[model samples]
Target: MILKKGQLSDAILILLILLFLFTPLGFYAKVQLMRLFSFAPSIEKQETSQKLTDYNWQLVDVEGNQSNFSINRGEVIIINHWATWCPPCIAEMPSLVALHEDYGEKVRFIFLANDDSEKVRSYLNKKDYAIPVFFENTQTPTALKASSLPTTYILDKKGNIVLKEIGAADWNAKAVKDLLDTLLVEH
Candidate 1:
């Protein structure tokens, strides 16, 4: 059927609106899609010979207790910088939880939420995530600051950044576990 000019423009506008609503708008959606197709952690192996920055970054637990990552020395460290409102962050939490279950005793998993304690606590409570959750109690070190949501840093016992992944990833994958196992052995 033939359509009037004004009607055609209105139809195009509606189509565009729908597209925007359904498509990935921000970095979060793009990361989420990337995680869905690849269930393994996107690991960029760093040279173990290189030294990592000191773990003096301060963080506060949900109870307001102060601590620094230095306390977890001599163990593999997994620090995840995430936020509640980030879709990619939420998407990869399950894998993190599972990864914790498998390696919680051997590895130190620290989830650093860029959000407030109340929001993070509420989110964790609702989701029943048992991993340690902390909020930044002081200015985050430039090295620790994430360029994007869902960034993760895996450190060996010597505090060297072994893997620095910038997007959501499947933390429970065998490769991830294998890497953790290797790190555990080296320590």
Candidate 2:
């Protein structure tokens, strides 16, 4: 059958849409879309922010070493809950890695994995990521229990949760760096 000029363009467009909606390209497309749209997470106001006053929680390191949350008391902390299979989590990882690379010494970063997925280890190794990854073996602290994957909370030294983001974000953005700098000077 002979194709009309406009019909051919319409047909190509439909095929391209189907390919993006069905194949592995779909995941890559979603990641790119998320990366393009993600902005720095917003900080909470002092009066409206939740504080991590209770440091009663446990986390097991990748080496199976157990540690109490109290150890990070009086420190600026960035806690991110993510999973390997989570698309948004994957999307935000590169930015998170860049942030950690620059501020790893100044900030205490805990990348909390919701489950002990072997894929998590492999993914990190493949990427050569140096971000600290930990597992919650016990009950999560109420203020830090992530309702969704890719949830991240930035806590000031005083335990006030300054930022709580629940989706993909540009963790390496200038706004985030500025916030971290501000938190560093905070008591």
Candidate 3:
């Protein structure tokens, strides 16, 4: 069979197009094939070396009390900066409540609601969330910046930021609880 130059070019172009379309599948297959390459640290190793004392955050307690964390002092403080209107913050309320119930005394769970005290009080009155929520007066760009809603900061026993997740997160997730437990144990 004799093919013209244009016909050969067209066939080659179509084959190239199909290859481009299916090349992603090969990339995905390679990832699956190499899945064993994934490496993760063990729980014990992760906990003991959790660097919570990185960010200098002003301390706010469960009882609506405000204080300053002197470096290497207050260990294992979970500072959740949230607002009343944030959906992710509201969705994670139950977990926060559970965290308070389970490890409130064991660790310091500080719920800093970034809103007016009246609004926070009103919101609290509706539901029975026992976590003491406080109001932070620090400016937007201060030591503890609550610029975004649902910004959570985890501080170690020595008053260092071990982790900071800026968004709504499953507070009751095993990973989160494990990390918190590790932080508490360090204290």
Candidate 4:
């Protein structure tokens, strides 16, 4: 077959795109893209947000200590549902860790695992993350149930879900910090 210069360049470009889309490198690439483009989640108006009726989710830590969501019921909480294999979750983890490091004393952070306990432990250990992680011991609360991987809920002191993000977001953004600080003081 005869090929012209433009056709050859187009074929090479297509081949490169195909390789990038199919190889393991694609995973890393997607994670980088997600991190690069993620934004802070929008705040929900108090009048329009969902309030939790119960805070009694049964959960177990990686070390198998049983816990209940009621422990954090009256505090500002950040509950993130994530899996080790989810690219968006991985992408948002660094920022989330940073946020937790700064607010751990003032707010409770829950890194909910949707994957196997051993795998979640290994992944967090490999990444040197000290965030608290939990696995469902019995059942998750309806308010805390995530409809998708990488979902996150920011709850105010009264159990009002102030922010519910369904995908990757920059949890370390200034607006998020401001919101947390504001939520910390409200009655």
Best by lDDT: 4
lDDT of 2 by residue, 1-187 (tens): 9999999999999999998888778778888898889888875455635889889788888778899889999999999999876779989999999999999999999999876647777878899998889998788889999888889999889898888899999999998999899999987
Cα error, residue 127 of model 1, in Å, equals: 0.9
* Per-prediction TM-score: 0.80, 0.86, 0.61, 0.89
| Residue-pair clash count for candidate 1 | 0
Better of 3 and 4 by TM-score: 4
How many residue pairs in model 4 have overlapping backbones? 0
Model 4 ranges with Cα > 4 A deviation: 1-19, 44-46
Cα error, residue 26 of model 2, in Å, equals: 1.9
Tens-digit lDDT string for candidate 4 (1-187): 9989999999999987887688768778889999999998876455735888888788899999998888887899999999998999999999999999999999999899999999999998999999999998877788778989999988889988888899999999999999999999997
lDDT score for residue 121 of model 2: 79
Query: In order, what lDDT does every prediction score?
Result: 0.81, 0.88, 0.62, 0.90
Per-residue CA lDDT of model 3 for 46-150, tens digit only, reads 343344333444545445566654432565777788876655566566667877788887777768777677777777878866676766544322434566867
Model 3 scores what on Cα lDDT?
A: 0.62
Q: Rank the candidates by lDDT, best first.
A: 4, 2, 1, 3
lDDT of 1: 0.81
Error of 3 at 16 (Å): 45
Question: What is the TM-score of candidate 4?
Answer: 0.89
Query: Which ten contiguous residues of candidate 3 have the minimum total lDDT?
Result: 34-43
